[model samples]
Target: MRNFQKEALILSVRNTGENNRIVSYLTKDEGILTSVLYGGPKSKLRSLVSPFNSGTIYLYNDEAKHSSKITDFDVKKYHLSFRESLFKTWAATLAVEVVISTKCAGSPEECFVMLNGFLDGLDLLDENQGQTGLIRFLWRYIGLLGVQPDTTNCQRCHKPFYSGNFSQNTLQYKTGGVIYSHSENGFVCTDCYKASFDNPERLLFSEITSKSVVYLQATSMCEPSVSRNMKLSDDEIASLKGFLYSHIESSVGTKIKTLHSGIGIL
Candidate 1:
């Protein structure tokens, strides 16, 4: 009286009753799912249940039953280094948290594809790079969540932003979001920024350093290999990191534990 079949990405797992575990996964067709796995605690199966693994999972559900159970799973690829590097591991963990916490049940195919790409990106990291890879992963994850920051133009005046104009730049941490100057509502020209700041409530802008601007623009569009080739200045990296962290905190709406554990943030 039980039915079975599923291929899923293991998101998280925790030991439950003796030799049992509660496993969470996201399926290509069924979306996010939680299943109880009996005898998983001390068995070989436990190795397959770790985070960010892609596997074929065998599941069973009785026709008359309401809950499904995962009987077994075989890992297709175990991304070991992703689980090893402090930054890559935590970044992958954060990506998982975003997917599990924000994605709706039965999310679209795009979600799965994006998740796969994220894992692939993590696998490409090496020790020579700073947290750039992790930062890119987090940024793209934010895009997947549909809360990506507006990096295009002014939030209020709707003018295009150029790097040359602004002597000072600013961004609101809360709802108003990224702006070029204290005046312009969003990213704006220095002239427009000055004009807008003259009138309170027109726009609020934050001064972004030249190096910061270059790094942000470059990282967002550059290929992973290209990003690796590029070296960021200390001040530039710090500014970019602060910008990304602020956006993540504002958009994701939760503090990442991995970020706070001193395991990922570099």
Candidate 2:
């Protein structure tokens, strides 16, 4: 009758029969953990096991049978604000799906810290601010998960993202901007793109605006614990939303159902 005590972030919950459920959690010690909670909707324990909630959890591990069951869950932060609005819920759900997809590839502790800041920022931010924060969070999470986009330089040419003679100024970018090449699986500089796609139909991709590239570079270096009030313009938001979501969708290899279905609110 082994037992385990851990601090966990509840990622998802699924009903099992009429009186039980299976809950998945992200813990500091274990990357992802699933345990059966023996209770139904009306049970107090069930209510505390909500997704995105984080806190100490007690599990009774059946070592002989190799399974675990939830005995207690002491919620520290419900992150109830995610449930307050559909916009927040979409971003939160997307984050959960991404985490589950990646299985928190890096160290469990680092992944936990990253997700903690993400939920905290979402809770404090309004819809618009949450959009920026969500972009930041997804980029950071993908980076940690080893699928981050390389917006800094061209894959073929091996030069810093440049246009005309402005290579000296890394801050300035012009031209038709960078292209997220599906075949190349990275950004291509103007020269490389034109040389490769001469009089061709680029059916797989469109240009990622210079501004979007800059945003990608900026957020890539920025820490995940950035302030919640971080803002972006409407244009920036739209471009980033498309670029980040598409990039994540491609990386995760699945349709981002939350974004696809929540198009109205999102």
Q: Choose the strongest candidate by TM-score.
A: 2
Q: Cα lDDT of all candidates, in order? A: 0.63, 0.79
Cα deviation of 14 in candidate 1 (Å)? Answer: 1.6
The most accurate candidate by lDDT is 2
Candidate 2, residues 164-257, lDDT tens digits: the string is 3222343556556777777556887777777866555455565767657766676776543332333457876787778778878888887877
User: lDDT value for candidate 2?
Assistant: 0.79
Superposing all C-alpha atoms, what RMSD in Å does each candidate have to the true structure?
6.4, 3.6
Candidate 2, residue 57: the lDDT equals: 96
TM-score of decoy 1: 0.75
Output the lDDT of residue 129, model 1. 50
Clashing residue pairs, candidate 1?
A: 155-186, 169-206, 169-207, 170-205, 170-206, 170-207, 171-206, 181-205, 182-205, 183-197
Question: Cα deviation in Å at residue 197, candidate 2?
Answer: 4.4
